[model samples]
Target: MDSALDYKMVFDALVVPAAVLTPDFVIVAVNEAFLAVMGRTRADVLGHLAFTAFPDNPHAPNDPAAHGMQVLRASLQRVVATGERNALPLQRYDVETPGRPGVFKERYWSAVDTPVLGPDGEVKLIIHTVEEVTDFLHQLRRYGEREVDDTRTALEAVTTNVYARAHELHDLNERLKRTAGQQRQTMAALKEAIERQRRFVFDASHDLRNPITGLLTELEVALSEPSTDTHEILSKLLRDAERLNEIVADLLELARMDTATPGDAAELIDLGRFVVEELERRPLTAAVHTRTDPQVMVRASRIRLARLLGNLVANAERHTTTTIEIIVTTDPPDAVLEVIDDGPGIALADREKIFERLRRLDDARRKDPGGSGLGLPIAREIARVYGGHLYAADHPTGARFVLRLPLAT
Candidate 1:
């Protein structure tokens, strides 16, 4: 009999959700029960760090008691250090919905972490087991109502035992109060969820309407005017279709960014050199000048960084009169990159508003009717994810957009 096979069989046979992790918290393997409970597949989590695979919900409350990842990390660390099993208290850890980007389902869990020790008495691997308690918690909240009915029945039957009935009544009052509070919290959470969904639908539909309407109008005109040149009609249809495609692409990108977890694969990039290469690769209608400091370097994903730069440059091209300037410099612990244009500058009041989803100023609409209005938002999100910021700063001549990122250590 193969011992390894026997071990695997026993591990999979367990009825509860269980996963095996390395000492460094990397998910080495997960059982069927774990996959079912976590709403994930093996490919989604295997070989990834535990925290990275299941990140803490960014929308969760700021209370420490609601932070499941923090508690779980501490428990795992303790088990590794002491080489003993540890049971965690009830935790409210939400999980992302399977196949739905940017959607999370509320969840509660009761978990235990046990360490496997080697011959030398050091921790080898950690076995993490969890039981979902979300339903149970909901049921507990409803217990007060059920208890009240039973108490009323008892009070009627035990009229002679006044003292006993009085104590029962007092306890029931406390339970009812707690249940009322719980119900209020649940209602608040539901309201917030609905509002978020409503905003998302509205934003997507609002931007999509223009391109769809234009496409339909073009098709109708082509049908009504048979003498119109075939080449011109096809060109108009193609342009409308491309606009629709770009809007859809940008929406999908934003959704992905909303649910993305911080990655550990960042590399040090030379900001000045990177900017020069990106400009040379892309064709620009306006002349672009560069004032780069070679000493400015930052740690980031190359692809995402390039996208951020591209968005800034594209935005500048849309509004610049003739020339745009790209400046790279360092501000102590941060690397600063600024994109300045020679056209009309952004008003102080509209600086923040421009970053809102699908928000377009009057001038912007007049300049680029086909624009999706998502480029600046996407660029800002990327900057935020990298522990940086993108903002419009006061400039003497035109709109100046600045990006600041932590310098590479």
Candidate 2:
């Protein structure tokens, strides 16, 4: 048999507010946690009927059916009768203050009661554990009330302010007219921005898809036929990969320029020498001709100028079979560079629209599957950044792409 002192020590060691009760709901033992929570000494509750010691508050409303004592009694009885644990949701329970006896303090608690069975499988005792939730419940109620009060105050202020202005009809009409005008302007600008973003996404996806598709297809075929001449197959795959890399790089450059303002440092570059040098860098099967003014010089970003010139020249070379002609001339405040090719010239209706992102001719697509359709658009964007312009015109036999930039002061 366990000693009474040992049982008391075990009960006092429990951390949760727990008590052991007999089958008739008399308190047998209470832990230190229960003593602290209930604000009572062991002598006050020991061997006392549970409901008798902490009965429903005498000052509480006379509604026995809704009382805390009734609810607690029902839960404890259910646990003992069914031989199963029972849990009670948070409920109000007033406890007598320790020092000021007979004064009950308001509290809320969440409780659970479990049956302890003996050797004969009968309930020997009931273990009841409780956790206090009074402070938390009160804080939550206060917070909700504060929010409602704030909302009501704001609504009242708005109502009063609006009613006070009801007499100023003419002034209100004028202000509303101005506000409507401003809204129209804002909507127009927003619409334009949205359209630009839409086009950018569509063209970027379309331009990037081709090379990526080719790269995947090539890799798949190469992997499937291991016994074939892998060296040749790898060379083709390498070219496709390089093409994808170039398209990605161009797309990134376009994205950066879209957010960039255009004040890069400008330098005076000799137009004739610049044209000749740039042409020499290209690997071309078509013959090249140059007609340049010796004194032509432009003040611009050399990198942008180079990219614009390279794109125009490359477009002419790739799209046409005729000899390429490079021309540089001065027009007082501006310098001009022209790249002419004996390819089919752009249609009159499509000339302006061709500068749009992803605008490509059917023949061009057939001739160059690797083209990202970004070259011309990017070239024109670079021209605009340098305060210049690029446009295509009808050549006698082919196409003429002209570039104009501010001349060096």
Superposed model 2: Cα runs more than 4 Å off: 1-179, 262-264
TM-score of each: 0.53, 0.55
Candidate 2 lDDT over residue span 1-409, tens digit each: 6545676777788889999899999998899999999888889899999898788756656522215667678778877776777665445677777688678786767788899998988889999899987776456556656777666655545533432443244246546656987999999999999998898788778777776787788778878988778888788878878887988878877887798855567788998998888778877767889999997877777777778888887788886786888899988788998899888778888778778777788867887777877889989898788788889887888888888888876
Spell out the clash pairs found in candidate 2: none
- Please name the candidate that would achieve the greatest lDDT relative to the true structure: 1
Worst lDDT run of 10 residues, candidate 1, spans 158-167
Displacement of residue 358 (Cα, Å) in model 2 is 1.5
Q: Would you list the C-alpha lDDT of every candidate in the order shown?
A: 0.85, 0.79
Reference-based lDDT, residue 71, model 1? 66
- What tens-digit string does per-residue lDDT give for candidate 1 at 160-264? 243244335535654665698799999999998788668767977988898789889888988999988889888988988888999898888888888885454
The Cα error of candidate 1 at residue 303, in Å, is: 1.8
